[model samples]
Target: MAFNTSGFNPVIHSSTGGGSTCISGNVIVSINTPGTKLLYEAPQDQVAVTESFVELFQINSTFGADAAAGGSSVISGEYSIFVKLCFPNDPSGLDKIKTVQLLTHGATLDYTYWDISPNYSYIDVASAADYATLSYDQLGVGNSDHPDPIQTVQATSQVAVVHELVALLRNGKLGGYHFDNVVGVGHSAGSMLTQAITHSTRGTSTP
Candidate 1:
């Protein structure tokens, strides 16, 4: 209930799919994850961005996974991520549930992609089914903090952010709701992040 609401939209209703009320806001997340070097130099323009991608692909194709192999240091940062938490408008038992779906959007898209409209809104569908939903703008995308693109926002750091978010949801730090269960849902690149989180054994020993 005491979530940071700076520059956040107040409560809103989704009527197209069903009557679902959502609190659109932002949360500050801090995380530490293994870091890797940028495969290609940072681009200066749109064309350069494309060229950088091409170069990265060529290097990967030529060297396979070895091209990206390297020792990793711990990368840490505090970032603000835009998030929306929604629940069914009707007074069903769903409001008391602690389970939630954590949604992450693909590259080039924001949290809005999940709730494009009432008719096509994923949040509305979940709400009607008596499930709570939480969607966020991944770091370096949309309203979230944008750090050094090539260095700080790599795949490992993105996965770390998602893991941190899952911890927050489970520990009752986010939205003051303690969710014992978290289901991660992602699109495209986001799906890769979720997969990494699912299969990761990074924090096992905590050495």
Candidate 2:
């Protein structure tokens, strides 16, 4: 994976306690892979929704392997992902904190899901605990760029985006902070994406 970033926020002071600070930026990620085209159609009603799932399950069970065996032209695109990094004011030392949490939200949500408010924000909670947090709006959501949903915004591509983010954090490219340990935290569909990252990048550098 290769990426470029722009629109970096120098510093955004948190109004919440614990003297936490935040910085946000947009990253443009590009990857090359066979494009995924789903044949399923959008359901119109509750019953149709169930029927659509059943139909998709049956189709996958029948032709999934054959489809996987087929080859196609690579689909590639650059997606701008909006991300925020929050940490406690390091009065003691930055070296004391070497771990960062990578937060990913489920479908129909964005980065703000982790930061609903000062009192309820997970970023604030982590900062108060002396830990840093990184949250991002996945492609096609929030402030990020939107490409063809079925082709460029597939699960593999989503994993690729998060993977590059981990690289940036480990290499201190974002906020000039290098974290030896990066953790993955996700909700619902985001959890599946994180699991995919762990599985696909096994025996390789990943969160």
Candidate 3:
């Protein structure tokens, strides 16, 4: 069952009710094996040291999803993983106190924190790039000009990409795209987006 990789929608997100509500948007997924492998290496402490952190409060309300899925397979079925890094707006530092809660199928998951150092350091490629350049815009609707808003776009795109990657793994089309197992890893805004992805639906639907 070879899946057609073409015609897939980009993942994106949107804001509703003055930041109180957020709907999923278009999402885009990229595959980076080297980076993904480095993220999961060795002792938990080692992984923490190697990986940088993103500050959610400092990040803007709008964000793009450019997640990368990669890994090698062991035996059990196939494994696919995606990583999202988010930086939120927190000039007052009050937002840091704000914690994001994750829910899957309407149940609350445990609250987790990322290893954020005093001097925040996370590489963001989109910062340099123009938001207009992205496939999705803020509408939460679809368009070639702008797929949807950044947040929804990222979430939806991540879901779509993960779906495709997992489909590939299940069918054994992805040779090295395998792993012992798979799980969602996110920090700050990325964590929020992961929560959205975990519960989002396809084709212009909001979750």
TM-score of each: 0.81, 0.78, 0.24
In order, the Cα lDDT scores of the candidates are 0.74, 0.76, 0.28
TM-score between candidate 1 and the true structure: 0.81
CA RMSD for every model?
A: 4.2, 5.2, 20.4
Local lDDT at 75 for model 2: 64
What local lDDT score does residue 83 receive in model 3, on the 0 to 100 scale?
22
Best by TM-score: 1
In order of TM-score, best first, we have 1, 2, 3
Among the numbered candidates, top lDDT falls to 2
> Which residue segments of model 2 deviate by more than 4 Å?
1-7, 15-19, 39-73
Ranking 1 against 2 by lDDT, winner: 2
- Give the poorly placed runs of model 1, Cα more than 4 Å off: 1-18, 56-71, 92-95, 201-207
Residue 110 in candidate 2 has what lDDT? 90
Per-residue lDDT tens digits of candidate 3, residues 1-207? Answer: 122222233222222111111222222334322112111222357555444233212466221122222332211121122222122222233223222222111112111122112222121122122110011211122221223222223344444544443443333233212222223434555456556655653454322
Model 1: per-residue Cα lDDT over 1-207, one tens digit each:
223333355545453455577667677788888787645455679998776567557833653354356546567989888778777777546448777999988888888887776589888888877788888888888878999886788888888887777877777776566787788888998788787878784556110
Counted clashes in each candidate structure: 0, 0, 42
